[model samples]
Target chain A: MTKQRAGLYTALTLLAVLFLIPMIWGVSSAFKARSDIFEYPPRLFPAEPTLENFRAILDGQPFWSWLLVSTLVALVSTAVAVFLCCLAGFGFAKYQFRFKNALFDVLISSLAVPFAVIIVPLFILLAVTGTLNVWFALIVPWVAPAFGIFMMRQYVEQSVPDELLHAARIDGAGEFRIFLSVVLPLLRPAVGALAVWNFLNSYNSFLWPLIVVSDPDQYTLPLGLQALFGAEGRQYDLVLAGSVLAAIPSLIVFFVLRKQLLDGLTAGAVK
Target chain B: MSTVSAQPSWWRRNEVRLAPYLFIGPFYVLYALFMIIPIGAGVYLSFTDWAGLGAPQWIGLENYRYLLQDNSFWTSLGNTVFYMSFTMLVVLPASLLLASALNARGLKLRDTFRIIFFVPVVISPIVVALVFGLIFDGQFGLMNALLQAVFGFGGIEWTTDPLWARVVVVVLVLWRWTGYLTIFFLAGLQNVPRELYEAAALDGAGAVRSFLSVTLPALRPVTAFIGVTVLVSTAQIFEEPFLLTQGGPGESTLSIAMFIYRAAFQRQELGYAAAAGVLMFAAVFTIGRIALRLFQVGRNA
Candidate 1:
């Protein structure tokens, strides 16, 4: 490589390190006790690294309960979203139907509308129906993600052949059976991708849960973490611990399913 | 084949095509309940006098009229614009440059670097705000410590001072979003044809020239998508400002969404809040379309 090329590479290396600093900070901060956090010279390596924050967070709040609630909600919601998206995607991809394009357009356009725009009426509707505290409040809103359907449709169109569906039907398989037996089994990759995306979104969600679920007992992880910052008092150690705890599930899921996560994001963007 | 079955007319076929509708049934029903009806309700309520738990009075265009004269509403709008521009002008380019550099073939440990850069994108924004809040702490912060180490000057009150608080919020938005944008640009860059780069080189185009002529044009769609999404999302900036400054040290970082949330949830002025939301929705959609169009024109040129 030329001198300039080498120099450019070195510069890029520095940039990457700069990008890595926050994650380093988060992990390092999580390890430090209260005194070590605000040290004057700022300790890159905490002199007395501790897991007190983790312990406190687990003990102080109903951290375990909140974690369980968030996990269940994210998993259940993603499963529903993936299943519904598969059925819809296969139908859209395979069959020619009346008003298909019109219905699809409505769903596509709905993707661009911000969640904030719908919060008001949805909140009112939830309140009126008295479903505010139930798991359904979070699950129902996510069941029919427009982007998920769009993604699955794109995947199915590209991957699932029409002949397969025809052959299955020729064997006397019903439409529902064809979907369950033929289309869905082939859609596992898209399902996996959409599932991770949905889980991350549902888990990281803040605004909707904040508005809809008033009771602390019904709080998702993000909402529960937010409460730690509220009037009861700001315990920095406890908050950091809670934030770390809240982030772990998504991190594990992200790492395990990195490729699908990328696929889901870009495909979701393009479609 | 002995016989061929005839295809039925479209609607006749579709009547049994309850299959497609059935497939898509959940989304349609949920969209109506969760999205469409709510949007219509929000629009109708914007012209009324409704609090959280009461009948909405049909109070003409008073809410809109009030919004016109409200100084805080205007201030929040200005802040939104400021934050949007700050992120676009500074963060977008920085991330793009960083992405391009990382995508360079000469770069070693590429995947590790990408993962590091993408960490913030996955982490909770609320947690990011908390970390930033600590970093920008007035009395005892890492930022102040660094400042004292180098310049020996007093630390600026990051979250307390109006101007500084806005700056901090902008920084928080940038930090949270730049990594996310980098991943998008990286994805876009991976698809750019390498032959164009080789052609540019053979034509004696310098690295900069190749980047300008060959690389940038290929990134146009990705840029357009990210630019519009960032603009729209920034216009609704909430979590960072909400956690960092609590929309303070006097509404410096208060965004339109934050304003709407406060009005509806805290003040219980649901109708006026809906007006604020509708206005926000309009502004974001308008700005996004305009940006995408401008980017397309520039790309064509």
Candidate 2:
């Protein structure tokens, strides 16, 4: 048993290191001078590390603007998405109504619809309507994701009790009032999970943003980095530095809410 | 009796019944407008030729007929299927193994391991792709340098070679997704009653025996959920191939989504792209529905 356990630990530790190598390498290379980035022997840490890449990208590119756009979009989307998902989740969890199952099937089945199917027509639709603004295109359409509602429903079903709703109702609490005052507080952990999920998704979203946002000034972090990567002859220095800076917020968010996010994400799948 | 005699207002009477719809109304509205309507438009647009011009010309079945003869479309579809199969076959089992190890009794720093594994996924895919692109570049890449240092041979072309390009894409997919999938499996493993394992052990069953008998069956729902999720997502894969290889060395790694993007955006073949999109949607939706039914997902709900 001791030998087997040791083997497991050894394997897991090796795998953990393997998982972290790319990010670690990216961060290390971000600090390297352009000439030393592809140096023979490829040292894990740069010998003459400098902040030149960071300064260059920050000075030349609209780095801060991209950060601002990504942050605002992610935050707004997360907030609205969390609220809508929670409300819908609470409704599905608590109430039984006509066509309930059918409605849920419709929502759930939509998950299978690939984004590629809509990319062409949706772009045309937005373009024709002249409502292809960054904020509207990025956030409004995606705020009510079916996956979030499903996750929230699973969580609400598992965590929230029926008696609480009955008790709240008996106190003359309105449906929305009960959801706001009672249910929302209990849904904090799940909300954290969904918020982190939504934030990461919106902030990191590349393809849709690439398709929709044509203006350079309206670029998100991913698009900005991609353009810089391409424009600079596939150079890694500036883009690496940009990516490292871009990753900080997402890493911080994940680290802080690791427990809730991990547990809440699996809550739906496991059960 | 006196309380019953006092008539309740219509608002009071119908509030409970109506509140649920009102709560869920916004989601359905957005779903209809964004998803249902766009899909409807896509279906309509697939039957006509358009170039973002004045009007779409009616050209029934021409786009579909062209799609039937499009080699790139066929190649992209094949590559997508290959990726989907790789995830189901390679990534799924590997994650299950990782989850089993993580679920080991009294494991040390399990949460630390879990968090570290999951960090890759939290970061943007562009960053992931960029980092990977540098590491796997055919020349001056860290991977080649390390190979030459350790193994004494490092001449393999990673991006330029068609086969190696596809391999790199799958490797990227594996690295990015395995940890994310492990969390689900770990959660499922945790929920499997410990008593079952104990009982199997008491019955003289070995570790492998108990795992096959107890663990596998218990993990079915999670496996199904992960399977369907991976299937749908991988079918629409774009970024890895798009960023890493640009679907190149001759479209060896182009995915359906990338194919659609290339056709519509780059080539301005909106009608043809819409046709391809419709076919992909039909294939994915049908398979997804079939998988859902096979697994009996949401049957209880």
Candidate 3:
């Protein structure tokens, strides 16, 4: 038994190291001078590390602007998406109105519709309507994601009791008031999970933003990094620095909410 | 007082029946506008030729016919299928193994391992691609350097060779997604009744037998959910190949999504791109529906 346990830990430790190498290497490379990035017998830690890459990218490019736009888009979209999803999920979970199953089926089936299918027409639709503003285009269309609704529905069903809703209704509480005061508080963990998920999605989104946001001045982090990488020669130093910085917020958010995110994500699937 | 007491007002009386509709209304409204209408427009655009300018010229079946003969379209479709199969076969099973290991009773620092494994997914795909591109570069890459030191064989052509390029993409997919899927499986494993395993042990069933009979059956729902999710998402893979190889060394790793992006944005073949998109939608939607039925997902709900 001891031998088996030892084997397990060894294997787990090895796998963990394998998982961490790329990020560690990338972070290390970000600090390395441009000349030492591809040094022979590639060292895991930078020898003569400097702040030049980070300083150069920050000073020369609109790094913070890209970060701001990405953060704002992710934050706003997450907030709106969480509210709409929770409301819809509550409706689906607690109610048995007409066409409920059919409505749910429609919503769930929409998940299968590839984004590639909508890329062309959605772009044109936004263009034709003259509502192609970055904020509107990014946030409004995606604020009611089906996955969020599904996750919220599963959580509501599991955690919130039908009797509680009846009690609230009996106490002369309006439906919206009940949801706001009662249901919303109950959905805190799932909300954290969904918010992080939505934020990462919006923040990391590349293709949609790449197609829609043409103006360089309005580029998101991914677009700005892509531009830097694809410029005259690959701006590896700037991009690596930008990549490291771009990853910090997401990593911090994930670490802070790691428990809720993991548990909340699996709540729907486990049953 | 009379007005306040009059049948408790019409709004109060009907709120129960109408509240659900109101609650779910916003989602359906946005869904129809963004999802249904755009799909309708995509279908319409598929039948016409447009270049982001004036009214589209109706060219019935021409794009589809052209796509039928387009080698790049076929190659992209083939590569996408390869990617999808790899995820199902390689990544899914690997995750299950990882989850099983993580689920072991009294395992130390399980949470730490889980978090570390999941870090790749939290990072942006572009960052992932750049890091991977540097590590796997054919010349002077960390991977090659390590290979040379370990096995004395280093010239693997990670990016330049067609087969190696596809392998690199799959490796990236595995690294990025295995942990994400593992958490779901771990959750499923945790939920499995401990009594079932005890009963299996009492029946003289060994670890493998108990796992087959108890754990596998218990994990069906999660596996189904993950299966369908992975299928649909992998069907539309883009970033890895696009960023790493640019579908190069002769379009060997070009995904259908990349093909569409190139055709529509780079080549200005919007109609052709839409046609390709329609085909992908049909395939994915059909497969997803079939998988949903096969798994009986959401049936209990």
Candidate 4:
């Protein structure tokens, strides 16, 4: 490589390393012994790595239960959200209905409503519906987020051809049948991307679940991990361990779907 | 033809007539119930004195009046504005440059760098704050240790000093979002035709000159979207600062969201909290709309 090209690559590599250090440090500290965690000239790797913190969290705390709750919530929310988005998106993309634009406008505008503005009244509504501490409450509000619907509409417009739908209709295929068999199959990549995105969003959600689920058994991993930090012992080691563990599932989801996710967002929105 | 006359028009048929509405109804129904109704009730609650129970006593504009004199509320809003602007300024430019670098010709391992940077976006903000909290610790933080080891400088109190605390929060916010903005710009960068750059190059424009004349103009819409999104979400950024400093040693980092949460839950001032939320919502919405309009005008110019 020429000198200029070599210098550019080196600069880029250094910046990338800067980005990677926090994650590396977080993971390294998670394994260090409680005393070693705060040592001077903070080491990148533990002097003598140990799993005692992880063991303590798993043995005594309800870590597994929280993980289960978080996983269930993430999976259920993603499945329902993607399905609902596809239906709404396809409807908007293909169908000429009364007040379609007006209704869609309202939905789009509501996306701007600040979360704090809604949280109080939503809390009241949830209490009235006896939805607090229930999975139904945990999963319902996020199931058809307006952004997801908008994303799906963009995807449908880009990939799903109008002529195909017309031909399906002429073939005596019902709308639902055409959608399920023809349009949906074509949208598989987009759906996969949205599913992964929604899963991570749901998994990282803290404020809504923090308010809705009062039961210790219902705590999501983020909330549960925060509780570990709040406990009187103030176990930074345990909290760090829990944080890294919580991130593992998301990283796995991210690695598997990164390309699809980026391509999905790019296909319609920007590019 | 006889069958067609006997059959109702496609739009009038039962299944065909209802399919579109059915497909779209679930989303609107849930949205109205969960989002619209709650927002309406919040607006109403802002006008009354309700503490999560009993009949709400109507007291028009009283909460707003009290809020006018409330120093804490003002301070939190001030802190948020500062934090938001800091990250927006730093992160946006950094994202633009990084996206450009990643898009440069003959750049190897671009995808790996993209993934590395994007990790921060996926990681929980709370976790990011916690990690950085340790990094900024006065005594044994990685940052402090590095400074002393390399420059022989004394460690500064990152969490206690109000200025340093705000800086820490800004750094954390940038770490959590710079990659996100990078992805947005990356997508925007891809949409720009290479021919534009080539045309400008042929006109005796250097790389920087062409980038300015060609690249930045194409990214206006993307920047507008990012701006409004940041505005809306900045109002709700509770987790990061709440974890990092719990609003700090002197309430230096307290955001309006934290204030509202504490008001409703801790102080049972639901009406007051709702009022604050409604006010902030209106302000942010107007500002966001104006920002988008300005971006459009800039593009047209």
Best by DockQ: 2
In model 3, what lDDT does residue A261 have? 95
Mark the 10 consecutive residues where model 3 chain B has the least summed lDDT: B1-10
DockQ of each: 0.46, 0.87, 0.83, 0.57
Our tally of clashes for model 2 stands at 0
**Model 1: per-residue Cα lDDT over A1-271, one tens digit each:** 8897788868767866766665667678888998777767676677888988998888778998888888999999988888998888777778888897777767655644766666776787778788776588888877878767877887888788889987987776778888898888887777878888788888888877788778888888888888887746767778887888788888898888877666556653432
Residue B134 error, candidate 4, Å: 1.6
- What pairs collide in candidate 3? none
Give per-residue CA lDDT, model 3, range A214-270, as digits (tens).
999889999999999999787788899999999999999999999999999989888
- The list of candidate 2 runs beyond 4 A from truth reads B1-7
Residue pairs in candidate 1 whose N, alpha carbon or C atoms collide under 3 angstroms: B14-B17
TM-score of chain A of each: 0.93, 0.98, 0.98, 0.96
Q: Rank by DockQ, highest first.
A: 2, 3, 4, 1
Give per-residue CA lDDT, model 4, range A117-223, as digits (tens).
78888888788777764588889887998777877887888799889988988888888999899999999999988998899899888888877887887788988
Q: Which of 2 and 4 is ahead in lDDT?
A: 2
Over B1-301, each residue of candidate 1 has an lDDT whose tens digit, in order, gives 4367666557545444677778888888888878878888889988899886668899989999999899889988999889888888998998888788778875677777777767777788778888887777888787887788889985789999999999888877777778778877887887788898999999999989999998888887778767776777777777888878988988788888888889989998989999888887776766655665666421213
The superposed Cα distance between candidate 2 and the true structure at residue A236, in angstroms, equals: 1.2
The positional error of residue A221 in candidate 1, measured at the CA in angstroms, is 1.7
Tell me the tens digit of each residue's lDDT in model 2 across A1-271: 6999999999999998899899899999999999999887788999998999999999988999999999999999999999999999888888999999999988778888899899999999998899998899999999999889989998999888889999999998989999999899999999999999999999999999999999999999999999999894977899999999999999999999999999999988876
Q: Can you tell me which runs of candidate 3 are displaced by over 4 Å?
A: B1-4
